[model samples]
Target chain A: MSIGLKKARAVIRATLSKGREMGLSPLSVVVLDPGGHVVAFEREDGAAPGRFAIAHGKAFGAVMLGMPGSAQMARAEGQAYFMGAMNGLFGGQVVPVPGGVLMRDGRGRLAGAVGVTGDTSENDAEAAVAGVEAAKLVAEA
Target chain B: MSIGLKKARAVIRATLSKGREMGLSPLSVVVLDPGGHVVAFEREDGAAPGRFAIAHGKAFGAVMLGMPGSAQMARAEGQAYFMGAMNGLFGGQVVPVPGGVLMRDGRGRLAGAVGVTGDTSENDAEAAVAGVEAAKLVAEA
Candidate 1:
């Protein structure tokens, strides 16, 4: 309930628009409550297979770790060793795409997350960010 | 709980011990409840920054979909669709890693998940499997 379903849908709409604006191909986007539960998601046509999942996967990595996927690269030698262990844990459901949104309530506690995949990681991230702005949620600063 | 902390830890310890036994570098491991919450986690001395979270993210994807990351490759065509829809269902906590463990209770109920990243994805998965087997839990058929 951090961001209402109405807003969640709006974010998706905005994300799609952003994807179009960026000239990225089809994309997948997801929004999650702060506790990291799904609230809404959308996958546009023509995205790569696993593209949607990877976006969600990367976003999961970002939101749960409380940062962005780009930043995770610096956490170690990079995401290989780090990513390897994670694959073992979840049985290999981790995709490293960028572009996810974290939602906060009006009071500004972390409320949920949004992740998008398809196109470059950075482009995907831009779409998610645009969605968050449309929803009026701030990233945890 | 599919793999309780006690068992999960045993799996982690054994996995790590095996890694050292095999001359693999230090690894980070995470076990998540069926619902994809952290049950137990271990970060070896050299784990890269945020590697642990990434592993968890991918593993989350595997557990949510009941498939291996490799399986996702087959479904890449539908991947965008999956991600778009699933991220919201999982609240943005799942990732589609290449290899991870799916913790299941007897009688085929999902208990939780295990993700490891450090060595190779296959090696990380092998270690997780060893841990799950050590914990006396059954993998899905």
Candidate 2:
């Protein structure tokens, strides 16, 4: 019922492969289970050193809030202080960006999340969506 | 070459399975690539709430220092101030304990690290070593 390791790796592989095919910068992708613990992760060959942590933060944020990163951004728009406090409390694990997407199971229950980092936020989000679809799950972004 | 997501997940699964067989507490495991980036992670169903971060910190500490967590503990034995400074600088990501083990490639080159939590330090380290060996890698601890 949950997003297990096999599916998480599928999502990561799909996201990175799509990034390569689209000529985007090398990427780092992270998958997090519903409890915000890492499930699987990968950093493409040429990804920047910082991309791994960023991707993890984005995915953790999505899973922790039970929403897509884009929605978290929207919710933080007028509550900068609250968002900042939350980030501080979690040791800066929350990333308000478009790269994080919530994944749902066949029954529409929140399963986990995927986060991609390397290029623009929009591109990252696109890759995350592709990853979700590749894993045969629904992406809520 | 690098510790890919597949190998990382393999290590985690091996470790958790062993833990269950040994009747240890539910565990959280983490694998990190040479660059100190997460490769894969898992938290067992009944693992304590704080185990995820502790597992990650232990693995990250091993990779960042290029040594086993026990070695880091030894080095920090008489350098409390220095270790404290390092922890402060890295936002407390370093965990000096026996649960972290450095991984080596076939050629004995440093590859990454595996860390396990939710049991006694010795038991955690034992699990990590078993995990690394299960993945057909070397555990230098």
Question: For each candidate, what TM-score against the reference?
Answer: 0.48, 0.75
Candidate no. 1 TM-score = 0.48
Query: How close is each model in CA RMSD to the real structure?
Result: 11.7, 3.9
DockQ scores for all predicted structures = 0.06, 0.29
Badly placed stretches (over 4 Å) of model 2 are A1-10, A13-25, A63-67, A72-91, A106-108, A134-136, B1-10, B13-25, B72-86, B106-108
Candidate 1 on B18-105: residue-level lDDT in tens?
7787777668888878877788888887454456765676577777788755554345334544553454466544445454677777
Tens-digit lDDT track of model 2 for B22-141: 889988888888888776677676566577689988888888877788887887897878767867877799888889889998899877888899999889999888889999999986
* Residue lDDT tens for model 2, A25-138: 978888888887676667765566687689988988888777788988887897888878878988899998899999998899988888899999999999999999999999
Which residue pairs clash within candidate 2?
A: none
> Any idea what lDDT model 2 has?
0.83
